[model samples]
Target: MLSATDIEVSLAGTPVLKGVSFHAQAGHVTAIVGPNGSGKTTLLRAMTGDLPYRGTVRLGEADIAAIPGWQLAAQRAVLPQASRIAFPFTVLEIVRLGMMASAEPPPERRASEALARVGLAGFEGRFYQELSGGEQQRAQLARVLTQVWDPVGPEGPRWLFLDEPVSSLDIAHQLDVMDLLGDYAARGGGVIAVMHDLNLTAMYADAVAMLAGGRTMAQGAPSVVLTDTTLSAAYGCDLRVNAAPDAPATYLLPHMARRAG
Candidate 1:
């Protein structure tokens, strides 16, 4: 399990996250959701050690800060919101970079398998820079996937930390990526995603954390956290949530949202 307790993060002397606590079990998809500037990404950065923070982030029994960089790389992989390559590189070459952190890297076939997983099977020889934004996102995902190819390592379960992973993809690709994450979790890997789409969160996330004012407003099962009242209060907009009769999911109606008087 991964857990953060009393997390406080400040950027340039301005606090961004305050007293936020979170927990995610392995073999589950945990989502962090909030309105813009709500510190969703800030907290993720803190967890990933990209930002300094006052808190304890534990990966299982060991503090993440105590883990060595190389060992940590083998334990987890992160996919940023966007990636840019200055020099032109082929998709296969970019994906193969993921193997650099491994003490004993897997065979070259892993990269091809990852590309196939992300729906980019035959584009390995193409230049990464020429790919569309959505395609680029998928390629980056493939890289991250190749980094932690196995869900369970010799030490324990591996983890994937993704920031707005499907933000650049179309609707079909969004579902495809989310389903892929779910399958990863099903195979005993931990998945933590910073999500913007609440509908996708409802459909895919096993646990949800809603942030507001740099604090966690709610954390629990989606059905419990994604409520009309909690969402309206956090987003500061009048919004309605409805349950799908045919599916075990919830959806928010943007048309039902209205401005305050």
Candidate 2:
């Protein structure tokens, strides 16, 4: 499991995250959702040890701070919000970067397989700079997957820290990526994602943590955290949550009419 306790982060002289805490268990997908400036990405950075903060973050039984860089890379992978490649690198070359964490002889096969998993099969020779935005995002995911192929390693459970993973993708690709992550969690790997789409969260996430004003407003099952009252309050808008008989997941709709005209 990935657990954070009393996480606090400040940028320059301004506070960004305040006393935020949550746990994302293995075999489940945990989503962090909030409005703009709500510090969702900041909180994720803290958990990934990318930012210095006052808190204790643990992966399984080991503190994240104490883990060696290489070992951590083998156990967890991060898919950032955006990746900028200054040079022209082929998809295969980019995916191979993740293999740096491993001491194995050759990772070409695994890299190719990772690309296929992300629906980018036969894209090994394609230049990353030439691919569209959504394609680039998938390539990045493929890179991360190549790094940590097994969700549960011999040491313990592995994790995927994704920052707005599907932001660049269209509806079909969004479902593909979410379903991929869901399968990873189902295989006993932990997944913690910062997401903006509430409907997707409700459908794919096993748990949701709502953030507002740098604090954790609510954390629980999607059904509990995605209530009309909680979401409306967190987003500062009147939201109507609907449940349909045919659909198992809840849908969130903004009642624009309720806004001051």
Best by lDDT: 1
Worst 10 contiguous positions by lDDT, candidate 1: 252-261
For model 2, what is the alpha-carbon lDDT of residue 188?
91
User: Local distance difference test, per candidate?
Assistant: 0.94, 0.93
Lowest lDDT sum, 10 consecutive residues, model 2, at: 99-108
lDDT for model 1: 0.94
Off by over 4 Å in 1: 255-261
Error of 1 at 195 (Å): 0.3
Model 1 per-residue lDDT tens digits across residues 94-118 = 9999988788869989899999999
RMSD of each: 1.5, 1.4
At residue 141, give the lDDT of candidate 1: 97
Q: How many residue pairs clash per model?
A: 0, 0
How many Å off is the CA of 123 in candidate 2? 1.2
